[model samples]
Target: MTTYNPNQDAHYQILREMLIEARQARGMFQKDVAERIEKKQSHISKYEGGERKLDWIEVLQLIEIFELSEVDFLMEFQRRVFEFNESTQTKVLQNVAKNAAKKARVRAEIVRLMRENSLSFSDLAEPPIRTRRHKSNR
Candidate 1:
């Protein structure tokens, strides 16, 4: 199984984007949100950059400051996450498939080389290392 970092994951990425979008929708700048929430502008910037994660307290404060409906926020967030997830997943899989095809072509070339040179599959392997053994004490 593959584990992606939070930055690479659609959920966190979408959350960060949605946060910035909500703030922008309200015509609020980082300075405004910072002042209203009693935080530094860097705090707003950091959280939106995914440098800092927003806890429930900050979340509620932003929700209030943005005047976003709870139901609307949650629904829109879910929809965006789903759409981002699907599209990004498809892009990643397509790249993987292209890489697989390229590798297959390379392997075919290697096989052709082996046939021309009359070499076995073992010819592709590296030589084994030779280990020296010290004489055993009687």
Candidate 2:
């Protein structure tokens, strides 16, 4: 069973509403979107109703169908979905910075290891080693 978080639920609801508004603004009916995505109208309805979750690929398809600019969509998402309080916003920014720093450290370590081993980028792409069987004396 999944525990419910009000904040997460609210975010999803906001996104659902935004998707519905975007569709309406484009003068698109649920049936039109359904045909474009090869889904039933009910599917689109469920998605817009927040009864179904939209995966990244589905979201991308919807973006294309709506002919929305990626930047506009992201700006709307930031404005609507991430309407956090001041303290929360600060915390989120801090976390993002911390994560980026950690990623940089990890990348530096990987580079150091590659240099020490004299390994090229293609060396990392090579296939895994296979074990050979040895004959045993009876």
Candidate 3:
């Protein structure tokens, strides 16, 4: 859900819902849409029903067939995603801020260590401290 891997994400679900809603708004059946798009009714049914994955090209094609403005469709899609995921977006922003603070602290400590030890950046990039040298097997 964090990633935009289509149908799997809420963003994609919203897009699918919009597509179905567009068809309904035009008072068109799946078969009618399929004929216009030169696809099978099952083709329309499968994507709408979530049994098949819809790609970008097909989405644009459907938007055209639905007589909806493509730009408006996309803008509306974005608006709906933001509306639905407001809480999720807030949590994501908070996590990003928290991570930025953690990174800032780590970098400050690294700079201090470099200055205290008179070490270059490469010095901090050495092998792990826990990496032990194997003794020669006699």
Candidate 4:
């Protein structure tokens, strides 16, 4: 029995492994992928050699071209895809939270201005600033 060991090179090693395995399983030559994808056979060769990276769109095309239909097959491909999406979403959420803090500061400034002007809520069509006022005696 042999344990499976994938390449450790970070440059599309997984992509290359899956690409070649799927292609061979489908009886596809490198030329077939090139013809279907409108790319050169050398490009496909480089991609399968773990020397090239494919974008998401290109990966999808390759998936469809290879006719991958099994759950295990899909999971292998989608694992990296999900990680990519998750990291992208984290960045977007961080930016949104930063922008919201800035907006809150600006809103506080606006409310301070309304209080300095003694403006009512109706006068500005905005809520009046809440404050704890003290009573004075003569």
Instruction: Judging by lDDT against the true structure, name the best candidate.
Output: 3
lDDT of 4 by residue, 1-138 (tens): 967533224326656778788899999999999999898999998878766777877877888898875566668756865675577679889999999999999999988998999976689886678998888896
lDDT of 1 by residue, 1-138 (tens): 988674355576777888899899989899999999888999888988878887767777788889988778779888987787788789899999999999999999999999999988887686868899999999
lDDT of 3 by residue, 34-77 (tens): 99988899998988877887899999998998888989999999
* Per-residue lDDT of 6 in model 1: 49
Sequence-dependent TM-score of model 4: 0.46
Candidate 2 positional error at 124, Å: 74
List ranges where model 1 is wrong by over 4 Å: 1-4, 7-10, 118-138
lDDT of 3: 0.87
Q: What TM-score fits each model?
A: 0.69, 0.57, 0.58, 0.46
**Rank by TM-score (best first):** 1, 3, 2, 4
The Cα error of candidate 1 at residue 63, in Å, is 1.3
Inter-residue clash pairs, candidate 4: none
Candidate 3 or 4, higher lDDT? 3
Candidate 2 residue pairs in backbone clash: none
Q: Rate the local accuracy (lDDT) of all candidates.
A: 0.84, 0.86, 0.87, 0.78
Clashes of 4: 0
Task: Report residue 65 deviation for candidate 2 (angstroms).
Answer: 0.4
